[model samples]
Target: MPYIEECIQSILAQSFQNWRLLILDNRSTDSTDSLCSKYLADRRIEYITNATDIGMIPNFNQCLDLCDTKYYAILSHDDMYADARAVEDSLTLLENDPELCAVYSHLNWIDGNSQTIARKKFKTMGKVASDTIAKTSIRTCRNLFGVPLLVRAAAVKGHKYESAFYFTADIDFSIAIGQGLYHYVIDRPCYAIRFHASNTSMRDFSKTRSELNSIADKHRIKLSVVDSIRMRINDWQTRAGKHLFYLYLDHFRKFMPACQQR
Candidate 1:
């Protein structure tokens, strides 16, 4: 519930007020649904609760089914936008360039205490074309999660997140939607990733690993030998950094005991 509150306030604070939120409840045992239900008086949101726990992938598919707009953004429970200008910027890019299916900005990692820990930044070439990303697809073997991006719902017309991938479903979805000519990076910081004890990073490390391997296996044809080597390096750095971050932080150390020390 607290997670949902943080996300909603970020959206409501957006300089752009013309968006609707669709929350697809996945049979959470917690009071997640209750928190959203209380906010039903607000007409801008449309909430739907599923009878069974559809897992994350199916829940995302259901969310897509409920979308009635031209563009769509996925707001994960534990993450929020960093400021009021994010949506306005996203809308501007997406509407102006028909070739771009999505645009993303920098990501800021915040602690459970809401203190800044790190910022993930990207170098942007002036008026970068999504074609470069598409051309490099075969040479790019690693997957970058979330990445402060927004997607065009219309572009997702024939796509859906596969339920079988309980861990790396977002990776598969990104590969499919980015489609070589559509995903671009914005120049400013836009997304906030909150790290704490209750987050998914610590909850299913082993399963996540297996799922990541499965994703690479399924896309072997798209990876060059060089990209594969670079990907392995990037993968180790990402996971290792997460584990170390949680372990070093006095309060966060308890949140990731499930992670086997490497």
Candidate 2:
């Protein structure tokens, strides 16, 4: 609840003030209802509590059904906008370019203490024009080009998250969206993701990896031997890098004095 308030507050403090906030409480056993009620005083913020736990995918779909905006974004409760201009900047880019399907920015990973521990810089293809980028992504399958995306409501007319994929639905949906529409990367970190012990990405790491392959097969996307090997290597390297980073931090904490470390 503490973490979630920060996420909601960040939205309230956005530079782009002309926006509505929808807080869907999926039968949370916590004080989510009371907390969200506090914000009901503001006409722009709408709070809805589900009588039963409808699961994550259903909640996401409900959000889409409720949205009437030109552009919409699904924000994780554990993530927060890094700057006031995060939404404004993405919206400006999408508004200026009529052909753009969506616009998204890179994000930083923060620890439980709200301290930045790592930054993931998304590789941009400048502005994708056609299916070339999507075809390339099938073989590589490296990036899950999802979230923090200000996606055009019209572009997602027939698109919805694949409910079969409990963990890798974002990857599957990203591939689906990148099929024919044009997408753009903002080339800047505009959001912070809370990386903690309880995060789904950490809990379902193995399942997530297997689902990545399943998604490719389900879509009949073929990958060459070299491309398959490269993708595995990239995934392994990422895990190793995060492990090594934590090890270095542990060593520093043990060996260096507090003042010296500072």
Candidate 3:
């Protein structure tokens, strides 16, 4: 609710003019309804308020179901596009490569007030094989294909997020969609991910870790013994990396004023 306006404004400011914006409100008690009502004047935007409060993953699946375009991207209400050409650039990549299932780019981490924290860049770019992506996802226990990714409609015809996993469903969905396809990676950061107190990932460390382990276990069954051993080593590395990240986040928070702790 806090950042929804920014999210919609970013979409409305896109260089790609032919895009449609769907605002699926999951029975929010906040000023979401009134706030979104202001945007209904734009013919490109459609606001749908759910009669009941469906959970997050189900709402995401509903978005997928409602999409009728040749290419689609899901933007979180709390996040915004960092670049106006985000959709245009991603669409160009998919247009050039028919075999690519989706095109994803790096993201900039932003604070609650939309202040840029850091730019997250990936070393690799261009066409990456889906099998390699699946393996990397399993090994790293992370969703390397972050949001604002434009996915081809035909590529993910009937694919849906796994409801069983809470925080890590995107990782699972990434693995599933990359089965026999390739994904295009753009070098620039196209999206801005917000870090705040209410974020699910920020709230629960143990649950997130548990979900990551479950996702890894589910995907690692087909791996060879050597790969499995490597995954275990990588898991430890990821854990250490996360621990260091939390330490850094804590240090960062200490310097911020108490009012801006979020």
Candidate 4:
């Protein structure tokens, strides 16, 4: 709930004023309703509180169903747009190239307090091949594309986030979208993803890893011996990277009296 205001504010601050903001509350018990009520004055912002607590993936599907626009982007409650131009930049890409199914930008990792922990960037920009997106994601065992991703409604007309993949559905969705249509990439980091104790992936690391493997298998194409070895090595490296990230957070907290006192 503490982060909700900032998340809404980020949308309100977008350089592109034509977009609508949908705030979906999945029957949260906190002061989420009250907090979101403050933003109801804006006609563009719609707040919908579910009558019953639907699971996360269902909530995402609900949002997709509710979308009536040509292009839509889903912003997580804990995350925010990195800059005001995020919307404009993303929208421009889709507008210019009708062929692009979606356009995603790099993202920054931020702590609960919204302090930047790291920046995740990609060397490539512009139209990326569908096969390349799948191969790169598989090679790294990570989703190369991050959020503030603007997706075309027509491109994903019949698609929905697969409920079976609780953790890696985003990866699945990404690969699914790129099957025929191309996905573009923006060079700049346009989103900030929050890392906290409650993060789903962080909380269930092993399960998430298992799901990643399942996704890899489901989307498997013929791979060379070298590509196969790289996949295994990258998977291990991703696990180690997560451990190091948490260790760094712990060390940071130890030195900060404010964090220790809390």
List the candidates ranked by lDDT, beginning with the highest. Answer: 4, 3, 2, 1
Give the distance in Å from residue 125's predicted Cα in candidate 2 to where it truly belongs. Answer: 5.9
Q: Candidates sorted by TM-score, descending order?
A: 4, 3, 2, 1
Model 2 Cα lDDT, one tens digit per residue, 1-262: 5578889898998989999888888888878877777788999988888889999888888888888998988888888988789889889888888778777677787876687776788666347643555445444544546464578888777777877877767667766666667777767778888866566454444454466677778766777788778777766765576566655544543454565867
Residue pairs whose backbone atoms clash in candidate 3: none
- Which sections of candidate 1 miss by over 4 Å? 125-142, 201-221, 250-262
Regions of candidate 2 where Cα sits further than 4 Å from its true position: 129-141, 144-146, 239-262
Higher-TM-score candidate of 2 and 3:
3
Residue 20, model 1: lDDT of 83
| Model 3 lDDT tens row, 117-167 | 779887668888877866666656566777646888888768788788877
- Write model 1 residue lDDT over 61-139, tens digit each, in one string: 8878877788888888778989789988888888888877777787888877677778877555324455444324323
lDDT of each: 0.69, 0.73, 0.80, 0.80
TM-score result, candidate 1? 0.81
- Give the lowest summed-lDDT range of ten residues in model 1: 134-143
Off by over 4 Å in 3: 202-221, 243-251, 254-262
Q: Could you estimate the TM-score for every candidate?
A: 0.81, 0.86, 0.88, 0.91
Pick the winner on lDDT between candidates 3 and 4: 4
Weakest lDDT window of 10 consecutive positions for candidate 3:
200-209
